[model samples]
Target: MAILITGGAGYLGSHTAVRLLEKENDVIVMDNFTRSSAEQINRITAAAGRAPEVEDGDVKTKEDLERVFQKYNVEAVIHFAGLKAAGESVEKPLLYYRENLQMTLCLLEIMEDYQVKKLIFSSSAAVYGNCESMPVSESTPKNPINPYGHSKAMIEQMLEDIAQADPAWQITALRYFNPVGAHPSIAVGENPAGTPANLMPILLEAAAGERDAVDVYGTDYDTKDGTGIRDYIHVMDLADGHIAAAASQKHGFHVYNLGTGRGTTVLELINMVERVSGKHIAWEAKARRPGDPAENWADASRAERELGWKASCTLEEMCLHAWKWKEEMHKNTQKGE
Candidate 1:
């Protein structure tokens, strides 16, 4: 039986598909290229030295999903289809609700029909919106502030209920922190469409001279350098966490925080990128974005203890990997390849 990855051409999904393919798993990728493209599949093929069966389909469409389920001997699914921008979700709450929620609902119904009971959901730390504590854990109260986070929390609850109702269903929701960096091979990385809302991508853009200056939001926070601190995990480490989740024998619904369990300030990140990329990052101070947290890390001990997974990449390594991808992409664009 093969593993079916929804939105497999995306940043995280592409990396996970590469890792699964490298592990010799029969993998199939289903994507419509809404936020990604076919080039990601090419890169995945190049990196894994093998290609996954590609289905040009959207997760929200039943016909698109049914065709793949009819063709492949699917054993498990890693759902990564959804709109991710928090600000955009806030601006278009209905779109977020309709797209993100409907995609999962449709996928779950089809999976039930096919008797594919194993699943690994791509969730986010935004579900724990503005926590009062330092490091967030799996048990953190889910108080999502925006539609994007609300959609994720609602899907997680739906998965929990379904798992409780059915003994055969095995589900894992991996709540991810800020996933930065790229694959060491420079085969895949976080290259979002349009202006990126995340800090890592923005910093990379500034380093690549695409943007004029990086905005240092809220420099008066109580962090060591008076900047927001976030737990930035390498994308490959996150991909490995999914592999561990897929290989687990544990039953029922499980949730794990995928992060480095450490925080890096904004200035600290800028310094690291400059040090690694040899490019100076110019920045300007801006007021705190409304809903932005002062500090947010992760207590990923449960993932280590349960799934035998821990993020081992250093901050410098993350910066270096991301900068390397940016540089490579620049060269590729110049060559018009």
Candidate 2:
């Protein structure tokens, strides 16, 4: 039975695919290349010394998923396929609900039919919307403020309910904080299409002159630098966490928060990126984005205790590697143009 990674060419999925390949695990990648790119798959091939068997498919289609399962003896699934733009989800709530929720439901149904029970659910910390408390644990009350986050919450709830109904299913939900940085080799990273809403990518764009300036979401926030604070974990660490969760042979739906247990304000992150890229980041203070929290970090102790996984990369490392990818992608875009 091989491991199947949905959205395998995406930012986080691409990194995870390379790691799983490096570990000599059989991996099958299913991606539609909607939110991801073909270049990332090429980088994964370069990193792994071979390409994972690709299924040009989407999880929203059950037959597309079934075809992959039939082609490969899929025993476990790492689900990462979904629309993830929080702000956009707010604008188009129906699209978010239909795409995110339907995809998970369809995937779960097919997985059940195929008896492929093990699953590593891709979740987000956004589910803990506007967290008034610092350092949230897995047990934190979920109050997602955006449609995108609500979709993830719905999937988590679905996973819980499914696990409860069946003792045979082994599932673990990994709630991620802000995942930044590229792989150590800088081969594959967050190379999102168009302007990225995520913090690091926007900062990289401004520093690389892809954008005129980075917009600081809010300056009146109750943070050390008057900007929103977030726990940024390296993408490599997040990929490793997925591996640990997949390997844990535990039953029932267990959830873990993956983070470094530290927070870096938006301004501080910009400064670090500037330090790494040696490019001054121009900025404009903007109004607070609705549904954004002032601060959010993770108590990753549960992940450490259960999956024996903890993030080890520093903020400096995140900035350095992110800069590396940004520089490389910028050059590639120029070459293509």
Candidate 3:
């Protein structure tokens, strides 16, 4: 039996693919090279020391999904195929809803047809938009404020309904916090095709002199140091959480927050990057972005108790690894790698 990773060329998907490959599982990567590239599959191979069979296709197309299901003995799926920028989703709500929802619906239909019920969804902490508490739990009322978060919450509800109706399906939705850093190999990291929407990448850009300065969004959000606080877990740890969810013996649908229980402020993140990269990162305070919360961490005890998974990397290690990856990418670019 093989595991089919939709969007396996993406940042989170590629890291998860590497982890799965290291475990000696047959991994078939299906991607259309939209936000990622075919060369990412090669990097996955270099990182894991094993190659995954690549299928060039989009998840929105049923024919493409059906072909993969027919071609492989796909026993499980780790779904990471979706547009993930909250700001972009805000600007293009219709596109986000159509593409994100359509792709999942198509993938689910194909899974049902193939009788392959095991799935691990790539969810996000954005679903817990502006929670009333610190350290949001699985039971927190999913009151998503943005179109992107709404898409994720909608999919989680859909999965719950499907699992409730059928006892044969095993689905787990992992609500990830900010997944920063990269794999230790530095071969596979978060390198988006166009502009990056995440924090770490933008910070690295400013540190590398690729940009003028990092925009400190919302410096008066009632957080310590007057900046927003978030749970920034390393990308590798997030990848391992998917592996644990796949290995879980539990039946029925479930949701787990893949994050460190601690929170870090935006200012602290900037300082850490500067300290690690040995460069001064200039920043300018800006007005708060709409729908951004003051504090958002995770209550990850359930994942530990149920899936035997917990984040192990520290913030310092996260910054160090990400800096190393950025430096390596620069050298490769200069050397024409």
Candidate 1 total steric clashes: 0
Query: For candidate 3, lDDT tens digit of each residue in 77-155?
Result: 9999999989899999999999899999999999999999999999998888889887799999898888999999999
Ranking by TM-score: 1, 3, 2
User: Which stretches of model 3 miss by more than 4 angstroms?
Assistant: none
Better candidate number, 1 or 2, judged by TM-score: 1
TM-score of each: 0.98, 0.97, 0.98
lDDT value for candidate 3? 0.92
Per-model RMSD to reference: 0.9, 1.1, 1.1
Clashing pairs in 1: none
The segments of candidate 1 whose C-alpha lies over 4 angstroms from its true place after superposition are none
| Candidate 3 backbone collisions, by pair | none
lDDT of each: 0.94, 0.91, 0.92
Candidate number with greatest TM-score: 1
Number of colliding residue pairs in model 2: 0
Model 2 Cα shift for residue 18 (angstroms): 0.4
Minimum summed lDDT over a 10-residue window in model 2 is located at: 187-196
